[model samples]
Target: MNVFVSEVRQLIDRHLPHYVQSLQAEPRLKEAMCYSLEAGGKRVRPLLLMAVLEAYGKPISIGLEAACAIEMVHTYSLIHDDLPAMDDDDYRRGQLTNHKMYDEATAILAGDALLTHSFGLIADAETTEMTAEIKVALISIFSKAIGAPGMVGGQLADMLAEKKSLTVDELAHIHRRKTGDLLTFSIVAGAYIAGVNKEDRLCLEQFGQELGLVFQIKDDILDVESDSETLGKPVGSDETNYKSTYPGLLGLDGAKKMLSYHHEQAKGYLHKLGLSDTILGEIADYLVERLH
Candidate 1:
């Protein structure tokens, strides 16, 4: 799994810059796009997509464009998420955030460009080896996952929930859309590319949902347990924003237990799929164990 992750990361690192460079727009916009895209992070979404592809005995290259597209959307979200009007953080991935490094307007535009460009990348006829039918399917999946009914809706719910106490169910609802939808898209996108049976695709989608819950739970735990330097962003931002989190709603230990439960659930679904490889299981473990 480590080897697979390393390979995907390397491919993403190369492809992201080249894709951005291919754009013939404003130089500053391009610069801001590259800046945020190149900023180091876990690259988890794309890796998950590729891992699923690898698991199904498909070439990782088949999913690379869609994987990169998902990363772009993820990166765009982070850029906007750190704006002065949003999370308002000064740092991300161990460096100044897009809005902090460039002006807020540039950051906003850069994020918008990335978001729209992601769709273009996925739709480009020459970009990937996938059939037009599959490309359209992926675009639909990608759109729904990040659009108003998905991540955007989740973000709004989260913002509205700030400073307000939320029940466990409410919090779960927010995380499922905000974080889980995109993660689920990542897995299911690869499953679609592999032309897996409907049953396997459903199992992978279920696994993705559980994996996303585990991700958010661990993230909440990390905010309280880790430092800003370790997290590469302000720790306790959730608290500062008066946002409800698993750790705040449940004790730290309780959050850990919840995380463990979701982790097991995710692995269970993965096992049910009965893939020939173990990358997806390893990815589930990595998501729970990751510190930042």
Candidate 2:
């Protein structure tokens, strides 16, 4: 891993689990929320936020609250996504899925708690420099990213696309919302916190779009080529669920090509933003090249 990524990951890992602990919520609920938060996935969303902050020469502390909020939303999505009514996965990050670790009801409540508290975390952020305007903007973008028009809407579309064929554009639409929007939010959030100009923020949004494609396409490739142990989740589950994927739609080689194309596009956007030599560049490479 890059030294910068390692540092940010460590910062997130150390603090993420504790946020839910101090909530005035039920003990079991907090335990379940903490259980999934600590499961230790890539932490990619938060990393993107902080990395973009660093790229803009802003303090990482300026974005930490929003980073955690983004992560909590992500983790909640995963927990709910693993429910029996959804993907029905037994494991994630090499541990039992939340529903399996505790129970379905507890898992549901835990996700809800995390999702609701995330906004509060940002609103009440202890960052002395953050203003009400920034908090409100973050909350607005965030709700849209993970809510009806974004992740949830995309998820519904994904489920409906199962066992059916879709064109490249159609598949992109689903992944754009289900996966891309939140990733875009992560980068854009940093730009907002960094007080970047409109043109620069636009550059980051474009960069994030390409990176999101790289991530989802690589994920599709991994499902076919990697193992359950390597992924820390079941392999070939996409096929089993009859979901449309870049690999399924374009074939493995074709998917690789798409991934490569997006990776390059992201680099172009970074160059456009004058961030080609920064940690954002490293993160872009890591996202597409990662094994899991």
Candidate no. 2 TM-score? 0.97
Q: TM-score of model 1 relative to the true fold?
A: 0.97
lDDT of each: 0.89, 0.90
**lDDT (Cα, tens digit) per residue for candidate 1, span 1-292:** 8888899999999999899899899899999999999999689999899889889888888888888899999999999988988878888878999999999999999999999999998887363447898898889888899989899999989988888999999999999999999999999998988888888898899989998899899999999999988898788988887999999999999999999999988888877778524787888898888889
RMSD of each: 1.4, 1.1
TM-score of each: 0.97, 0.97
lDDT of 2 by residue, 146-202 (tens): 999999999899888889999999999999999999999999999999898899998
The whole-model C-alpha lDDT of candidate 1 against the native structure comes to 0.89
Candidate 1 Cα errors over 4 Å, as ranges: 125-129
